[model samples]
Target: MLMKPLIIGQLKARLPIIQGGMGVGISRCNLAGAVALEGGIGVISTAQIGYDEEEFSRNPIEANLRAIKKHLQRAKEIAKGGIVGVNIMVATKQYAEYVKAAVEAKADVIISGAGLPINLPELVKGSVSKIAPIVSSLKATSIILKMWDRKYNTTADFLVIEGPLAGGHLGFHEDELVDIDMDAYQEEIKKIISLKKEYEEKYNQEIPVIVAGGIFDKEDVKRALLNGADGIQVGTRFVTTKECDASDAYKQAYINCKKEDIRIIKSPVGMPGRAIWNPFLEKLTKGRSEIKHCFGCLEHCNPKEVPYCITKALTNAVEGKLEEGLIFCGDNADRLKEITTVKQVMEELTV
Candidate 1:
């Protein structure tokens, strides 16, 4: 099956591909804009977005808000009218502030996850920016749909189903990740699709289901379409693209990884994350480290209690210190071989 345009609310992408938002300078204006220019939905991750700003360490919220507008403007400049969206996690400390900033900048869309985005509709109410919530199971989809129907009188513009093999923080528990049952998960995706239909009809609108996590090539795209997905969101594959915003060392980490190098570990934000087993993680396995600085990024992050600062570790990775940083990747990172361009990656995945 050939890839087709994905229609999400008022926006449409020539290719039904969304570049999943990888944070800490991974997928920023350069990467997102390049993909958008290629007729796909480009996504910028809002997790510690202002890491490069001079004042970011001193004033995180202010720097991030400023960086949001800066990055969006830069992406729009490169997109040349193509669709460019922002991926803002609901677990972010200043969630409403970030959402409002994206909407204020007139971002094409906001794909939120890391938690249920029950209040997303309300945040982008008067703006033209569309809203999408990422879910890991049928239960989460139902809850968001039900809550939106009852309280917001609206449904998601689209929904992203991130399977267990996704990068960064996963939505699944430790046990589920230990031994994933693909058949059971596929059944869950079908169930979520069924629920999407009910809400689509109830609200008299289309709620497209976009499959994410572990999506790499054309075959994966075909499988998602066959499983009832309107489109697919891809993250890890983009890490190797020349247009990706991360440093050379950061991209090299993904290239150097093997299947055994990938490990499921705990993130300071209280979620299980998949990353390459590095010296930092090896050290973490031995004992907890003292928090050097807290960016006050996540809502539940405790400065005194958490082992280490996620923002710091990720920022280190972005700066090319692989051994001391957290290297996040999808389960299929080991499957990648060489560095490629964004255009090449999109073409390979577009059937």
Candidate 2:
């Protein structure tokens, strides 16, 4: 299959790839900027992004908003005019404000998921930043497209189809994912690609479909393209890259993990997430761990009630306190044996 540049609105990527957005200081200015500079789309995850700011502990909202601009500006500077985007989870507390912040900061693209982004179009109206909704099935694609059309007379600039094998918060339940059928999911992807045609024709524009989850190598990219996807969003493979913002130990965790070490766990935000089996997770199996402080990152999180404090756990892992922090990863993380650069990964996928 021949690689084609992914065009979303006026933005263009030399390769039809996007460095997956990892939160809790994982994919930030360094990784994102490198990906864009290397000719692919770079995405900064805005989840608990303010963790590094001094005001994060006192006023998370303001800190997170400030981090959005701070990171976006720095990422853009490193990008050197290349396309840079932000992944804004709808599950975040100030979802609308984050969307506005990304647009205000002049983000080239805004890909949102972790919940249905029903009001995304409204929040980004009159901005040049392209919007994409991360969906898992045709039903989700239909709902988002229909809702966007009915409510705002617009459609997604692109669509990211995340499958069951994805990391972090997944769209599918744990039960359904245990015996997921890739062939059946590919059929759903075909249908979604077909579904987008209607909206594309109506708006007289193209709506690219990007498949995520389990996409790791050139063959994976080839297969996705042959199956009708315009591009692929990669997370775990990028985690081990030198430019990734996570701590060295965090990247090493990907290299040291075994295939059996990966499994799904219930996130405190009420979603199933995939992560490595570590000391903290093993301890959780015995009983729930109490959260000392709540960052109030997710919209539905309660300080008193939840399996674990997501912000603290993710922050711990990103900072290299692996035993205490929850490290979210894709199923194929075990395949990584060494660290690489973003340029190498992009060339391997597109060459």
lDDT of 1 by residue, 1-351 (tens): 567689987788999999999999999999999999999999999999999999999999999999999999999999999999999999999999999999999999999999999899999999999898999998888899899989988888999999998999999999999999989999999999998898888888888889898888788899999888899999999999899999999989889999999999999989999999999999997888778778989999888888888998999999999878999999999998889999999889987
Candidate 2 is scored at a TM of 0.99
With a 3 Å backbone cut-off (N, CA, C), the pairs that clash in candidate 1 are none
Query: Candidate 1: minimum summed lDDT over ten consecutive residues — where?
Result: 1-10
- Would you estimate the TM-scores of all the predictions? 0.99, 0.99
Clashes of 1: 0
How accurate locally is residue 159 in candidate 2, as Cα lDDT from 0 to 100?
96
lDDT of 1: 0.92
Instruction: Tally clashing residue pairs in candidate 2.
Output: 0
lDDT value, candidate 2, whole model: 0.92
